[model samples]
Target chain A: MRAIILEQVDRLLAAQSGAAALRRLEAGEWPEELWEALEGLGLPLLLVPEELGGIGLGWADAAAVWQVIGRYAAPAPVAECMLANGLAAAAGIEPRGGFSSFGQTAPFGRFAAQLLLEPAPGRLALHAPGAATPGQNIAREPRDAMTPGPLLAEGALPNSHGPRALRLGHALLRAALIAGAVEHALALAVDWANTRKQFGRALAKFQAIQQQLAVVASEAAAVSVAVSAAARAVDSRGLEGASFEIACAKVVAGEAAQTTAATVHQVFAAIGITEDHELHHTTRRLWSWRDEGGSERAWAGEIGRNTLAQGGAALWPDITARDIS
Target chain B: MRFELPSLPGGSAGLRAELRAFLAEAGRDWTPAVRARSWMGFDREFSRELGARGWIGMVWPKAYGGHERSGLERVVVLEELLAVGAPVGAHWIGDRQSGPLILRRGTEEQRRKILPGIASGKLAFCIGLSEPEAGSDLAALRTKAERVPGGWKLNGRKIWTTNAHLSDWMIALVRTSPAPEGGSRHAGLSQLLVDLRLSGISIRPIRDLLGEESFNEVTFDDVLLPEDALLGQEGAGWAQATEELALERSGPERYLSSLPALTAGVDALRDVPGADVAVGRMVARLNTLRGMSLSVAGMLEAGEAPAQEAALVKDAGNDFEQRLPEQIRALLEPEDMPEDLRALLADLTQLAPTFSLRGGTREILRGIIARELGLR
Candidate 1:
């Protein structure tokens, strides 16, 4: 099932999504056809329950999808809508999803029909977007400030699932996306190193280039493992239960994003910094997404504070406690 | 490359609890300084006790006196021991690589004779791969084992042989024959299980920068080894030894060597204002590396030789281990910190350089990774 889903997503992205489409989206042109195709696949309702007229997939499945989306640097808020719809269902609000976005500060807010807002700790309120002040991230994706019109639904989040739940969800998704993007960037760098000639030889022929790519590969591999483990944790345990793994995933992915971006850009040299190159499509997303959900520094601080509070003896146990085996 | 999330058998909580209880009691008297040594702390009695509990050789078959447990179970035991800084050096090599190698490639009599001792933690082993002239380029080793009347005659010097002075046996990679004309340098190598107590063998301990004599330089002069001492097929040692090195590189030890420093730092800086961020970052990296290590172990259990993946893990893991102590040091104020924490920091600061050097140097591991990436 995962293989099929990932294959289809990869095929669609390969066929429809490209640098030109991304550039159009960034230029304030809506991805109407792409969004419709993704909607037809029921991607936005990925985490909604099967009984609720949506395909109920586990977090692990969502992680794989998010990674593909990131690999293509998808211009739509498919991941955001999927999570928001899932959150709405969990909050007992029936999904009437045209397009949904979730956050304390929503992304693609103007485009989303419903905005799932964490009005306060332990409270979730669904609202409709009224007017928006257009904003954008470094990747030029919409980060519009929405003036919410009227509340659609309001409910209290369960004690086990509070603000941290939303935070972990966002961080986990971003980490998954960054994992895919960085890996794609690595592939780009490897291809560039192999093809581009310098000093009468391929870049990859040089030990220095090989060594740098090796580090990029290592960082990319680590982020991939970290997010996979985090997704599995979420599948087995809820947000609070998998908080440590999720936090670690976010930190690892964020750190890898920086390292991989820097190395790949260096491998590409001057041409990579230009907008026309395919590398920036992924690298720019890496720079933006890493700071979007939660920065590595923020998550690391949380993990460190919690670890310290637990004391030295508990540190090992805390790390190993998530082991299902 | 994608690492599939490894799934372990259920009921690990019970195993972890049992190991934790045992380590807490056994390690009660160990100070921060002692725990900092972790795997380098060799204790025969401690190993025997663990073996008695069926922890050593947990993944080997029972015919060789093993417990026949799962690989994940062994991972649990190792991490538990290393996490608490248990002295596991006495049986680490035998259980981790040699015994496994023997089980895979040794003769029936050899397995029967050697594996039981290793499983029981009664016999200790050390690798004899590196020589004075063959540190990173092991193929350049000049160690020769000439065919004798009834056995082989060994004559060579092996340096950086960890536990050589204390171990009962050494698995030495030797030049069995000259490379064929214009052929591979790795062609004529063979591994021999040599008895350390042999008459022609001499062991001299080499003190490291930390004043620890955990490694040794072993010299062999016309030593006689029985025909059965040849482990696996002759002239296949390069492949076999590379496999062993992969095993050596992938385990929790790659990343957990500096854990004691981090743990001690956590204790000392528990109430410090802004220390959590650094500690948290280290913990995050440690946790991620552990996941990757476990994934590799899963690959091993599934009958895949993830040598390249293991090299990548060790490369990244060693970086984390080396940086951990320096990060902790940056957070510490020596005059205000606990003496034990300060001492552990000092010890780990000296020990950090070896973390990347011992298994395989960072450069060599990266070179391997580059080859795996098809770069040359």
Candidate 2:
């Protein structure tokens, strides 16, 4: 990672800043200062390219930065901002201020600064990626287990309704960020292992603990390597490798992060589950990070689609081409 | 990186094709039932056929009866056999690795005597490392091998010796010396080729939770062997065992147990519902995993030990594989699934529980991964 990224990451983590300060961010709104400070570092403009007044780093460097920020359990839009900005730049549009979410159409387009509908709209048309609803949710009532929500982008956004384009940049960036989060979870587990003790000795000495931690560490490292490698390949091979590489990397990393977070929390014993333990934040961040990127199943499904389309054999070279680097 | 299913150099493709044809024909009648395809599910006939093609001992030189093919090429063969669910338990240990170990470390006579039969697919072998109490704790092993006139006399019970009752020979870890306080307890465990058929040895089947008898508990009652039985060197078993395990503990076999159920489900639905969508996802995951796996194999072919990389493959691949059963549950059970699919899922759920256990537990797998990351 670049020293600048690390410095910026450390500065935020130094204060445990952002929505992290809120007791229940899963339900609460994001803070204003955190967003302002993040933009001040040009985080939102990261993918804007130097030509677009942004400090454009390669995906590997970007992934590493995301991992560091993830370790601190920062809020959603930090990395998301970077990705949306990149997409805006790629579309050759100068952004005013708006965020983009990928996948099928979001109803309200809450974060969308402007809609680049898959089917480019004709003049005087306010289009909608039609029939776009949020992922299936629990029935709303006291009779059922209703998930608390000020749901982000729940209903349709005015007249804009139709099928949408797959935002490749958003997908790729989310994968990278998720991979980074998995790496972060592994690190948190390692740090916990070093300091946490049981039976009058450091817990790191336990065979069960060591092996689990090692697996988590290895997974994150390998995926981190793979994701970065894929990112580099994107430059050389264009989009071919990036999709599969990022998809594979993200799915692997996401699964690892999900499992590792639970495993680490388990190893931390009862204290880890409490709201105040430092470990709580690690797992919480992992939770949010995964939801932000969709679930592992979603990404795995995408990977399967891309992979089957390319056939298994093309995957290696597809991501390893000269354009990827 | 994506991996191309490489054609074998020279006549290797022909050999793979021949093996593929043989397995396809042999398994034509195989259903989820009547097929034990566990460690004991090895096909002696298939082994003999592979021997006939001179495909075994593939990584070694020709002097010892090996085909001298590249490891990368051999990976394709290994993967296909496991993927196709071929009955390869008979000669798997010998063909896949024991032959290479003996060729690498055994004397001329040892290589000549062992390698030829292995290549020809006549000989069979099994590993003996775990004990009744030391299944995952290799350092806790109490099996002792004492020095004697001609060679060492082994006396101790070896537990979880896969297919020991059926094996002709064994590559076993026996304690030759004791560990002092805080010493490397895993040290002094020598690896030797213990002839299982020799007198005074007892093999007992340790039925797994699946009711399969692939694992065994073998007690060596002063089992005698000549000086030549010592593999590599005395007191070198720990490293040798670790090396062999690096081969055993990783590979497509580590995670491909669910492949059959996956294949069956996909085939059943291929003509039905949106099979294209479902199959594509599974194929993509398998492809990426295969890519990573092949890269490790390439590293091994280039003489780079890919233990950690292989561990990553095993962990991720197994996790991915395990999820396949869960993924297609709905399609399989459309209005409450078929008996076959239910049984298939049940079978996979039962048998694949220890995908991470037989070689090394999932925790052990993780330790290897973490260490590679410089975190521990």
Candidate 3:
């Protein structure tokens, strides 16, 4: 079932969300068709329960789908809507028909009918999207600062640390996306290395290029594993319970995004620096997405401080406790 | 190329707790410098105790004196031991690769003779792969063995043979026949089980940068081995040894070498400024590496030879292990640092270079990954 879902999503995104679509998105054109196609697959409600009039899926499944979204650099707020819809269902708020963005600075906020926000520590408020100060990230994805007009619904969150948990969830989403984008970039770089000839041989035939690509592959693998593990942790344990894994995921993904982007760009050389090539679509997103989800430095600081407070003896036990059967 | 996270089976928590408790009690007298040795800290008594408790060879069948535990169970035991920098060197190679290799490819007599002893921690084994001339290009090894009437006469020199002087036996990869002209250089190589006490065999310890003589240069001059000493099929040593390396490279030890330094630094830098961020970065990297390592272990458990994935883990893991001490050093105020932490930091910094050099070098591992990427 997971493979089927991933396959369908991969196929759809490959066809509909290519370089032309990305260029359109960067030019401030909404990917209405691509968004509708994704919605047709019931992706927007990916995390909502079946009883809530949506297909119920776990974070692991969501992670796999998000990877596909990242693979094509899909210019739609599919992940955001999925997360926001799930949060609405969890809070017993009626799922809106149109897009629903999460947090104040959600992508495509102007297009969303509702915004899910943590107004208080344990309270979740669904507000109608009001006036927006439109913004764009490095990849030109909408990061609008939407002002909440009026509260439509409010309810208690399932866990304490609601705001922090929601932030971590956002971080996990970006980590998954970064994992996918970095992987895609790696693929492009490898393909280019094999295709482009220089000095009467392919770039991949050179030891220096091979070594750099090897590091890129290593980084890609590390982030992929980190994000998957984090998703599994969230599946078995709640966001609060899986905080450690989520933080690690964000950190690892963020770090890998930097390393992978730099090396892959280097591998693509002058062609990569031009907008005509497809590598920038992924690398720019990697740069933007890495800092969006708390950054590696932020999470690393938290992990370090927490581990220090627990002292040396508790470090190993803390790491061991994360492994669930 | 995607690593699926493996779920540890039930009872892993209990197993980890038990191992942690044992390590705590057993390692009470160990100093910071001693723990800094990581897996290189050798203690026969500790290995024996772990064997008695069925911590060693947890994944092998019970008939071979193993506990018939799961591979994930074994990973839990190993990570627990390595996390605390326990002295597991005495039985490390035997439990990790040699015994498992023997069980998989050895004759019945060989398995019966060697495995139980390894599981009981009464026997120690060292690998004789790197010769004075051959380091990463293992096919360049010239260690030769000639067939005799009823045994083989081994004549060769093996360098960087860890624990060779203290081990009871050495699993030596030797040239059973000259490489066929214009043919594969890997052909005609074979593995032989050589007793260290054999006549005309000599071992000389070489001190490392950390001032420890844990590895040795071993020379065999016409050492006689019984005909049954052949570990696996003759002329299959290259494949066997490379397979053994995948197992060796994909363990917690690959990433946990500098963990003690991080831990010690964390304890001393609690009141220091900006320490939490540095410590947290290390912790994050450690957690991710553990996840990758565990996934590889799961692949091994399922009988999958994830050699490429293992090389990726080792290369990234080596980077983390090597950088940890330097990162910790950058975070510390040298004058305000505790003496124990200072000494450990110094030792780890010196030992950091060996992390990438051992098992496989950084360049070799990347080459393997590049090959997997179809770049070679």
Candidate 4:
């Protein structure tokens, strides 16, 4: 945990120089150039297995990168790209070059060489101009809503082409999202408390507010711990066991994100909610990311129901260090 | 009466086998949904069946319709119930604490009146200690009941009254006097058994974010109950409330609510080559928690007060419960899933936010633990 945290700190230190772009992101500006530079620096492919000539990091490592990404509030698709590539690498496949994903909204042509979408039917070939090829140019939404578009294209590919990388990589990305959002929210909150004056005293002096901030700190750290455990599960136990840890990871970490963001807004008050503040960017992104993969309650009911069916104990097998070893 | 239960008694294995046979029949052909009660919904009949099997109120003496089981023996029964998600919700409160409370304090007549039904699984109870104005602050309650002829006329309201509408009786707290000039007003509060059938009493369910109708806005208006309704002494409600809170805060239920989702999560990976090892790690932590909780129960059974330990266990368990939903979601649908699963996952994930808040928010719990540790 300490090593991973230190690695994250190093990542943050490297990105510290990108502070100016972070400010622009707060103003709803998508610094595509800076993001492009980050991708060039291999920050986007941080979770691609080392076997794939990538960083070969786990959920915790991805979380560390995301923490750095969060500090700058970078309006880049790093998490999105990592999610796409991580699973492909895991499944012994490699997806090279630029691909933008079509999730909730369509991402138009901006900085991508290709479009990434879930599998579609042959109907596109029957209807569209790129019908002769295996794929067609399609536009989709950028991960960060604030990103500006270059152009739009409407086309689709065959149903067989959906990227497998997103399957496993998505969890890592979501955890990164939570970790990033929490760090940024904490930063925004701590800054406000330190500088903002209330009743001729800093807000930090109030016990009520102090207690609230401490809770935020503890929750974020706890989620971070849970996510680290999930990464360990995947690394040690492989995919089958990793799912259980992931359940715990998403629920706890997601709540940490939601609670931290909500509390950050409350602690900062009017200033935090405004478009001009960094808090808005982190909070809004958190809202979008929380629903992207799955919600916490869905997982709880699932975990509990599954335990009941077992008619014994929960799914803790006799895992030893040698298992992962 | 400190009842010592061996960690791995010879009877335990035999009892487990017997319970399996009994539950297989009692729970025969029961729908899977009914078996997994905490997630699907609560059932009363199943609990009654368990009661008939002497499972409910298993710890009390046989004279009270109980099985007079030891602590370890009772633990086996409870572990099976929770592990299988038996619809024990109806009898959960009654069996866990209400039966014990009645046995400890109620007059012989009151005990006979309630314990038999409770042991028979005919009664459901909810605690009405929280009010809209008073949540974490239990002693600050203003719901007052004055001296009247046949009984005391009640007039205050309680919020977050879980299953109050379905419950036959509510063990509630009300202020018997003015705030008492800040000299530890906790002593002036009193507890009463308000039968839900009274016409003057009203229970309006409070709709929560989850759209679950578990909470009720219980209103008391000129409700009269016989003075024999008072449990213990008038000035003793505070102590009683503390003891009840400790009981409430302790137990496997605190951590086990998310067991179903966790099970589903592990199940999805069962066919995978490496799931066993991962499941083992998760299970180890859960077992560790369960062990701690059981040890606390053992302490409680030994006549040792373990409020701080209970609070710690509850908060830690809830913290884990709150994490289960999101982590599972990430595992199940690491990326964007199909539209329907996504919708279902969204609801479950949203449901995780309140686990910490429902029992006792993390803050209040931390405060309790801190006070226990003498850190305050």
For each candidate, what TM-score against the reference?
Answer: 0.98, 0.70, 0.98, 0.54
lDDT of 1 at B197: 92
Over 4 Å off, model 4: A1-325, B1-8, B22-40, B271-281, B334-351
How do the residues A1-325 of candidate 4 rate in per-residue lDDT, one tens digit apiece? 4365446544643564343554554444555665566666665566676667887666556655665555544356566666555544543445565543433232222334433433332111010111111121111123322222332322332223232223333554566557656766776676777788889987765656665665565455445555555665565555445665565666666667778877888899997766555566567666656555656554444454454346333343221111221
Q: What tens-digit string does per-residue lDDT give for candidate 3 at B1-376?
A: 7577788999999888898778879988888767778677778888899899998888888888989999899988988888878888899999999999999999989988889899988899998899999999989999999999999999989999888988998999999999999999999999999989989899999997667798999998988899998989999999999999989998999999888777777788898888887788789889889989999999999999999999999999999999988887787778888887888887787778889999989999999999999897
Tens-digit lDDT track of model 3 for A236-275? 7777777888889899888889999899988888989998
Best of the two (3, 4) by DockQ? 3
Q: Can you give the DockQ of every candidate in the order shown? A: 0.80, 0.14, 0.84, 0.02
lDDT of 1 by residue, B1-376 (tens): 4467687779688899999888878888997767888888788998899889899998888999898899988998899888877878899999999999999999989999999899888999998999999999989999999999899999999999988899999999999999888999999999999999999999999998878898999999999999888999999999999998878888999999888777778989888888988888899899989999999998888888899999999999999989987887788778987887888878888878888898789999999998888786
The TM-scores of chain A alone, one per candidate, are 0.97, 0.71, 0.97, 0.72
TM-score of 3: 0.98
What residue pairs are clashing in model 1? none
lDDT (0-100) at residue B142 of candidate 3?
94
* Candidate 2, CAPRI quality class derived from DockQ: incorrect
B35-112 per-residue lDDT for model 2 (tens digits) = 425344766776888778666677778887877778866766776666656667888899766887887678888998
User: What lDDT tens digits, residue by residue, belong to model 2 across residues A11-57?
Assistant: 77566553345344334344466667776777767766788787777
* Tens-digit lDDT string for candidate 1 (A171-240): 9999999988987898888889899999999998999999999999998888888888888887777767
lDDT of 3: 0.87
What is the two-chain DockQ of model 4? 0.02
- Give me the displacement of residue A110 in model 4, in angstroms: 61
The per-residue C-alpha lDDT of model 2 at residue A221 equals 52
